[model samples]
Target: MAIRNPMYCGKIFIEKYKDEDCHLVKGLHEPLITETMYYEVQDILDGKKRKSKLTIMSPSMLPLRGFLNCNRCNRVLCGSASKGRGNYYYYYHCSSKCGYRKKAEEINKAFVDELKLYILNDESKEFFKTAIMDAYIDATKGETKDKTNWIVEITELGNRITKARELLLTGDLDGSDYKTIKTESEHRIAVLEAKLSEAPVVAVSPAEVERLLDKAIVKLTQIDVIYSNHDTYVQREVIGSMYPEKFTFENLQHRTANVDFLFQLIYQINSTLREKKRRASDRKTCLPIVAPEAGLEPATL
Candidate 1:
């Protein structure tokens, strides 16, 4: 009762408790503890709070534990080891009452196969690298101009604040009006200063950019190889980058997984190019260029 009482934190109710006419007085006595700590204890007694410490995953197993969704209930799957015949077996299962489950070995193999689908071929890798470099160049083209503009605006706002101060000193502007102008100008200057701070000190060199792109391309092209050779942490990172959203496993395969946008773009372009090349070698059989019907319709008014 004392743990739930506010009087322990130096508060007192003078009138009827919790009544509209009740008057509550705080600091009636010296507090033995802070009000925050007292309320937190009350919350625990009421079962309204729990420990906020994060539960760490096993670093050597079940890399896809929270990433996999149960096919039946769509809840994030949990993994655990089960003992049978004096041997331990691992499985990913749903916490819900749906009773969905799968062997960890099977699910892990399926995810590795899924990664193989996004691996870029040699031609696609080169094209993807070039496209990314070109886009980066175009994006950085106006970066210098942006920094200059932000710096100019910040300087102008600072001058405005100074002018407002001068007006207030001379009594040309009312104190309230001068204060308003100063506050607004200062806010604008702060925003512009933040943007200037984020700007790079020097432009990146083309050679340096190319070197980075080459390394990234290699990673993208050999993603499965890297995932297979890495530890659980790296494997989880690969899964996260490939599928930002949780995916379901059914029929011994991953289903409804959303590939990352960059990987999707690379896969789409490569597939389209392959289709075009295939059609070019057999143009007569392909009828995508022709209209649906044999007869032509009348012109619209």
Candidate 2:
């Protein structure tokens, strides 16, 4: 019987021969793409693409994944793949029954490109930096005062422990009562100490802020490529970190998401670009801003 396709032959070989028995079938017929290429494609399908030697450690891979949402089923979008004709296509699909697929490479590249554009733009960079700093400041507000209160409470707890010990020694309190009070005081002190240690430090310096921004930008820049290399669990983690909501794609062209804050940021930037184009159009016409209802206002008065 004549074999029609090399893939069909490979499938037959896989089904008929075990790994150790593959050598027995080497001379059976001429192979397709060589055994090495076939195996390479299989490895890629199995999600084992080799990494480069120059790769450095990065923390941004999963940090922003949480924020992406499905635009169709409203469920969180998940990474998926399909193999056809010896090639694999990677993409994100809705968690529910709604069929929405965006090629992984395209979406990742688009996200990274947008992030790079944002980072390179002075106004966008400044806005992002300011937002991050404002969030940090807001989170730490009253922390110092809270720490001071805890310190006072810790001291009082220590004093209470000493008083309980004294009472037990003087036979005014029973042994069990003394132990209970001491344990409670120590637990309180321990909790206060932990909280005090966790309190945020003073305002970070501009140099430190810049360093943070640089790191964030680098991670954001590398997310697409890194995610393309990672496995499903890692991809899910990455997506979950960046966007906690779901991404939905309905009818392939129309997409909507509940990510208000992120959508707002993107919309604002897009609007700014559109406004620039509009201004250029207006300059070509040399038209001035028109006042509204100037002639009719006196009639109403």
Candidate 3:
């Protein structure tokens, strides 16, 4: 539950010292967990994680309780399922004088309706997709070379480590000297191996990105289905990821500025061009559908 416990890092501090001097070096001891995992735990503990919005444990009901803020006073609205007659109802209640109140169903529907604005038309979808993939490919162009270099470095380090160990066993190297060299060599090998392992992110393929984007858009188009079909956990995850803060609902609509990136881009692009297209084909669904100009499609959204 706590990430601040440095005990997980495999080393203790030199007490009575300030700043980096207290924990300046690592001890020659085994680690319970990796530095990466330890930092991840720290991020969760520090509330600085990108996923901080969804850090709260999901409740059985009233998933939107902590996600909604009162529009009037800008305070978190508490929600609970209350039994009225033979069924239960959920509501978001204001904490202060605003006395703001809203039913969960209506609020959720409003949010979904707002999300629909971000779905791109077929043409715009193609434009935005190409742009996204092109950017990704450009970014990863150097990863292949980096991976190859890391592999070569790891091989060299491994051979050197083996030679050092041989020298130690043959009495050519003192025990202390062998230990220091081996530790440094092994650490370097580990670091390079890690780099090689992470060179090109496994999920950076264009097909995977497109598929995920399509799925997200499909859900936006069918928000009611998505919300009703999923469990409370999935529902909360979807909402939390879409909006990182407790958005206020005012006069019936959720005042959400933190819509999904793709959705926001689609909405902005379409707003700039007021033209609409007929539903030509199922394959050309969502986003603005416009004819290609000058043999080039406009890369929008």
* Candidate number achieving the greatest lDDT relative to the actual structure: 1
Best by TM-score: 1
Off by over 4 Å in 3: 1-61, 82-88, 96-98, 119-124, 141-224, 251-256, 269-301
> Model 3, 1-301: lDDT tens per residue?
4456565777555665555445534767787887788788778667877644646554555767687778788888988678998999888788788788888878767766765665565556666666667776677767866777888888888898899889988999999988898899899988888777766565557678778777765665555566668887887877777775567765326344576665566666666554443334433776557754553665554
Candidate 1 local lDDT, 1-301, one digit each (tens): 6667778778776776464576657865798878888879888788899856876754455888888889898889999989999988889999999999888888888887767767887868777887788877787768877988888888888888888889888989999998899889888888888878887765577789999888888888888888989888888888888877888876326345787888887777688778888888788666566455544785333
| C-alpha lDDT (0 to 100) for residue 228 of candidate 3 | 65
| Model 1 regions lying over 4 Å from their true place | 1-61, 85-87, 147-206, 250-255, 280-301
How big is the positional error of residue 65 in model 3, measured in Å on the Cα after superposition? 1.8
The count of residue-pair clashes in candidate 2 stands at: 32
Question: 15, model 1: CA deviation in Å?
Answer: 54
Positional deviation of residue 202's Cα in model 3 after best superposition, in angstroms: 8.4
Global Cα RMSD, each model: 15.3, 16.2, 16.5
Deviation of model 2 at 52, angstroms = 26
For each candidate, the alpha-carbon lDDT, in order, equals 0.80, 0.59, 0.70
Sort the predicted structures by TM-score, highest score first.
Answer: 1, 3, 2
When summed lDDT is taken over every stretch of 10 residues in candidate 1, the lowest stretch is 292-301
* Candidates in descending lDDT order: 1, 3, 2
